[model samples]
Target: MNQSVFQKAMNEIHSRRLHASAENERRFQEINTVIPELAEINFQMAQTASRILHGEKIDKIRQQNLQAQRYARQLLVTHGYPEDYLDMHYTCPYCQDTGYFQGRYCTCLEKEIASLSVETLNRNTQLQLRSFDQFSLEYYRGLTKSNTKGETVDCYAKMKKTLDYCIQYARNFTAHAPSLLLYGEVGVGKTHLSLSIVTEVLRQGYEVIYDSVGNLTSQIEQEHFNREKSDINTLKLLLDAELLVMDDLGTEFQTSFTDSVIYNLINTRLNRNLPTIISTNLTPGKLEEQYDERIMSRLCAVYQVWELMGEDIRMLKMKERRSSQYL
Candidate 1:
């Protein structure tokens, strides 16, 4: 919990409180102008406290206040308005948008803090550039591959199914959605599809982090060693995000620190039953070799593994550009 992130969340809560108050005042004024009797009732209701201070019997004043409130509500309903239309409507009724209740921080405030933290962490990534619509299956057209079951599969058909699956996965994503292991050779759209899922999941208002494993590991290493001046608890954020997407899994600089960090992150998230999406160029065997049995066992047991197949779409696009330039 960084101080700046907490302050930002508090500021948002203050803004919501102010908006609710302003809107309530506006509604009261409008009703006062439209119905003069409501103004009189409101005046009487406002005088209850002063009347009690001036030696009026507390029960009598309280009764008068309740009667005034009932009359006001009746007036509102008779005039085609809800009884609570003039009440201050808060975005969160629990805290009245003040961000605290019962001497503790409200759940709404905690959620805001979490959302803001994810936003801060993802500020550097280009999450907007990738989408499912931009992913094409044309690159796999007329290609064929043999599956593990010793059956010939049409690459285009297989990839089309993969594309559809990714789209539906994004569209119907939830916090409890199954974790994913997207493994394939370079430029087979592993990054693209994973990013596509990330964009949609984010739009659906889940906290998602998308970054390369190498970059994230570097940041974690820096924060862990106090080599960088950052207040954010990077490892905690990664573990707690609603959906964590780590790309290029095996490309990070290997060290004891990175290995421990990666293993802890995976194990913690799995224990918490949170969803994570990992894209890697390494096959299952290579991944086991790169990490160890502990990491591979968890991934194989829980993750929905998808093996993307195709030639390098980047190379195909480059050739297309060159041919167009010649023409």
Candidate 2:
């Protein structure tokens, strides 16, 4: 989250690209070489500037950049011309290689790539469990069980506001942001909002993780029952991430061990001041009934619970689309 990590990443990127990694460096240097055209251009600029140094040209040394531009165009042509290219090309597109865009983080995008770098989400080597951009709000309908006039205006407003709030929170997250619990029915956008936060926080340079409750509990169970120590490493990852998000909490296969683990996780995080986000279809009262009041009450002290209400937005959208087709 601080600046040193970014500096290290930059150094690593350069080291991986230059000098000892000559073949890799060659790829970029090929674009930046002081070729014959570039050398001629530089020689002309220096010759004219020497006159200026002696007070001869007087506000009339043809701009060095202008000379470079002609050479750049010729270089593009020799390589096979493309009309309307960059007036000037960027060598390192990030930071313009100046290292910062404006006053904020120059390697701004480094944050975005970090969250996905985690083993479960690593886009480089495998398919993601889900993707943030693929989330659709069309799954939520504004209706609760009481009545359905398609969807309630109140529910839509609240969910939309919630989405906006979650986005803002992710953009502005700091070390002390409170933990969150997104409680709702199936397809209510809880997972979407949670994934969105993970995506944004990673972009902002914090390590975050998202996992299903069932997968988490199963891993914990295996780690506990097995004699070998290495498999328990999965739980270690969960406990170690900067922000850990557990999705579909109540739906996980519940055993006495799982119940104890869940309580321990919530309580341990609260004690350590580590942050966690949990999503479940269970209500607060239902959670108490399912896991016992003591564990539920302790969670209430440290987490903000958001109750999501509405029909599945996905189902509503699908029906709406089919109705439109019939019409």
Q: Which prediction has the highest lDDT against the true structure?
A: 1
Candidate 2 residue runs with Cα over 4 Å from true position: 1-153
Q: What is candidate 2's lDDT per residue for 129-218, written digit by digit as tens?
A: 344456555554444442212343566666666776787778778766788988877877787778778877877777766678887788
Per-residue lDDT tens digits for candidate 1, residues 145-167, read 64333456788988888889899
Instruction: For candidate 2, report its TM-score.
Output: 0.58
Q: Cα lDDT for residue 275, model 1?
A: 92
Model 2, residue pairs in steric clash: 111-202, 111-203, 112-203, 138-313, 139-312, 139-313, 139-314, 140-313, 142-152
For model 1 the local lDDT of residue 209 reads 92
- Cα error, candidate 2, residue 73 (Å): 44
Instruction: Give the Å shift of residue 302 in candidate 1.
Output: 1.5
